[model samples]
Target: MHALIEFPSPFPEEPGVVRLLEPPGSDIEALRARLRDGSYGRPFVLENGGLRALHFSLGYVQSVMKISDPCALQLGYAQRMTAFLLFNPRPRQMVMIGLGGGSLANFCHRHLPGTRLAIVEIDADVIALREQFCVPPDDERLQVIHGDGADFVRDHPGRIDVLMIDAFGPDGVAEELASFEFYERARGRLSASGVLVMNVAGNKETYARHVERLLTAFDDAVIAMSVREDGNYILFAFRDASFAPRWKFMRAIAIELQKRLRLDFPGFAQQLERGQALRLAQRLSA
Candidate 1:
């Protein structure tokens, strides 16, 4: 198991300044090797006061865990993914494609006692570092599988109530996991009233292409919320085309969830409402 490595703050002394620290002993050959072999890169952790961040690439933070509150959702996108609970407050089976620091997985395991959680991560190295992220042990309710996300969904049909695809590499989302076929397979893996949440990143063209594929597969039953902190879009796709969203009911549910989960569920509901409005405007403009 890869343990968390604490390093001094890489930020400049001045306020409002942030800097990325290069990994020790990293060079062109090492980077090339990492690109050639997915398992080559070593995951490391950085601590700045109470905040600890996990990084596979020095350029980006893969996950962040607060030392004081490890189970809290540290990133906006992580919190937004919980919007699935709004659609299905009591999901029976949930599958997560990526397990970076196990933020979402941990949150679900701790809060959704009745739900069965399964997380699939392609990189065993990341899985080895799960303990550093405070991910819980595998039990009947929660299990982590080291395998390809695309293959997992293809094999498991009509078993998932909530399917989350956040599988990403240093460059961007994995090619196999981003294809239209994979989206269709993900849809197949979901039970009736299932919700698919994906974390997508890239340039505008690339993002649009991926969103288009999801829209095509789900027949436009999709709404996207943009996380301004990291410029990543969290897309919620529903398996039931007739699943109508009611903001009033969602807000009420959010309040109940917020009280139970200690998250900003009401705010998240508002974000989804805004996303729906944006999608409607875009369609009208087209």
Candidate 2:
């Protein structure tokens, strides 16, 4: 269903794309450099079988969005992260420390109409592809900043209601984002009722280090639920150490959210409680 255009351009022209549609938007040179030089292991987008995905490596997929439905989170880890809604379903002020393909950002912008969102991303090249991924442009409720996530959390002016950090690099969570200092700063950046959600990656040893730092930084008020895909773990750390969630209520919220957001909410609710219990029992036995 594609008609090749009788036109000339530095890049391959899209099939069936004849006219400008509107005006030239994306910086062709930026994209070209990323393609030409590999952009020093920069993330790339792949489109296949009606799905578009962000790839950090040939074998690893960081994020995926349906071309037919962009905001729908196609990755299991991302869906697990949405369990944050179980903690704070309606956050007024939110800060997200990554903008991979804007799955969370786009969903927040479209669905959470009352919340103001500020997204900080370290890669400008990735930010440039926002339009390509259907990420909405900056507006009153949204601002995507090209900056280091650690610095953004450190220098954030005031406490926020919710802070979600999913910033990861090719190998794993970047060194800066995984450090004790960063977690402390993230704790300081949250309000009294704030919750911090992070997508944690690593094997046994690295995972232990991350858990230790999170427990120390947030005073041991952290809960983790494993997303059985690609070994991704979602961590929920509370700024307030005494904040305890009841299982019955959480399951109720999970049911409601599953109906609304199309994620495995009830499953996450059950898993988180069980995981926390297992950890506590192991500690007591020790």
Candidate 3:
């Protein structure tokens, strides 16, 4: 029988759980090769065990490649989007483009209870490996579709209240995904009052250039949240107009969510503020 491996968490668990597993070896290139050859999916530690990596399944959708030395979700992109949209009760139809470990999707399925959730991913092997982890299946609220996220939404005619672009490729986001044509298709898949959340990585300043492209498709766009130094940022774009975040309300919701999820709310709140402030500063500098 295979041995069960367990990892340890360094942070206070309130809003979410953070775990760091032991490292497989020192050779990352070998590890990447194994992944390419379909042999590696187990979790491993890096940076002298300060950082960790894992293959989180998206519940029969796709696998999210996560490097969690800093405990960043989507490298910290989802942190901001979760703060803004998690409590927004208006989105009954939620579509997620990427399904890494089903974190945001599972959280919504468990907490919202009434929302219909659909995740689109391109990899079939990732779907087959989901049960190897703990992602549940046969849920009435959640459905996993096997296909390219961009194409799925492009062909999907129904209106979506919230459209989340979480898809990422080995070379980073595909060229077609960040293209103006894809953004237009995403806009067409949304309702009049819909909010589009996109997760992006790399230089924060260069991120605005991508946002500029999205603005062509969206009437008004806003950087809902951003993290400094970390390669992840979450941008929330509106179909008709941008919606201002209610900070006090967001704080209240963050506190409540932390309590309900048994996670440390203080850190979550600080991260939210940091993300908002960074974006504001970036806007001023630009």
Candidate 4:
């Protein structure tokens, strides 16, 4: 049977749906086990099929990873890049570890206008599924490299302006993506002015630990809040360890930045500030 559920958030219009489809007598945990093995659910598309995104539901996890217009996720990544890297007007090259629905790659291709974008995806099936997700053809500025993200970044000796790690396994968070060595490789590939951004899912402390690993390699770390509660968080690390934004300026920037991206800016900034405050408060309380 099919069950539909909705998530309430500031951005109610975002495309997301949860389904519980299991045969009679099947326990939710049993079904979740199946999903953990990566063999459940069918392909999903929007009403018009205009957006390139996919979601598989197997009666497990609180909610399915509904990449509402994966292209939007891609554009969102580019917007984050705009906020951190491109805005500075430095020469730019972007390396994305996970192609997902190829939204970010396509976004960089169309918008950045002059940025070099390379996407490394481990799944060939996922790569074949790109056309369904609206990924365009190969071009001089855009290249799709099929390999492990860590391997690609490690093997390459050249510098990159921005590196985005959004890798997720069939079950959940990919363990290898979180290792200290991976951050070391990412740090090595970055130019002195480069920034590293990772899409991680979990609570604030869980997110902080992930950022902390990068902190070992890099001097500074900043987190960009997600639009929705209990969703993925973006962690950005910079080469120089001392990057700090003035609270007043950050608030203003978040206000102006809200209009530039797909998320609710006010909420995004507020949550980020709150998380930062909690992090600081805890440090002092200790």
Q: Top model by TM-score, which number?
A: 1
List the candidate 3 regions with Cα displacement exceeding 4 Å: 1-75, 203-208, 248-251, 262-286
- Locate the minimum summed-lDDT window of 10 residues in model 4: 3-12
For candidate 3, what is the TM-score? 0.66
C-alpha lDDT (0 to 100) for residue 80 of candidate 1: 84
TM for every model, in the order presented, reads 0.86, 0.84, 0.66, 0.67
- Across 162-201, the per-residue lDDT of candidate 1 in tens digits comes to 9998887787888888789998888887888899999987
The local distance difference test score of model 1 is 0.80
lDDT of each: 0.80, 0.78, 0.59, 0.59
For 185-247, candidate 4 gives per-residue lDDT tens digits of 787788877788777765566556666777676643554545343456667676555555456
- Ranking 3 against 4 by TM-score, winner: 4
Q: Highest lDDT: give the candidate number.
A: 1
Assess candidate 4 and give its lDDT.
0.59
Of 1 and 2, the candidate ahead on lDDT is 1
Pairs with backbone N, CA or C atoms under 3 Å apart (clashes), candidate 3 = 13-263, 14-262, 14-263, 14-264, 15-263, 15-264, 51-69
**Given candidate 2, what's the lDDT at residue 37?**
46
Clashes of each: 0, 0, 7, 4
Residue 176's lDDT within candidate 4 is: 66
How many residue-pair clashes does candidate 1 contain? 0
lDDT of 2 at 255: 91
Report the lDDT tens digits of candidate 2 across residue range 1-286. Answer: 1111122222242221111112245555554454444452656566656776665544566677788888898788888887778888889889998898889888888878999999999877677667757899889999999898888888889888889998887767788988899888899989998999988876768667977998899988888888776688888999999888888988889998888878889998888898778767876897
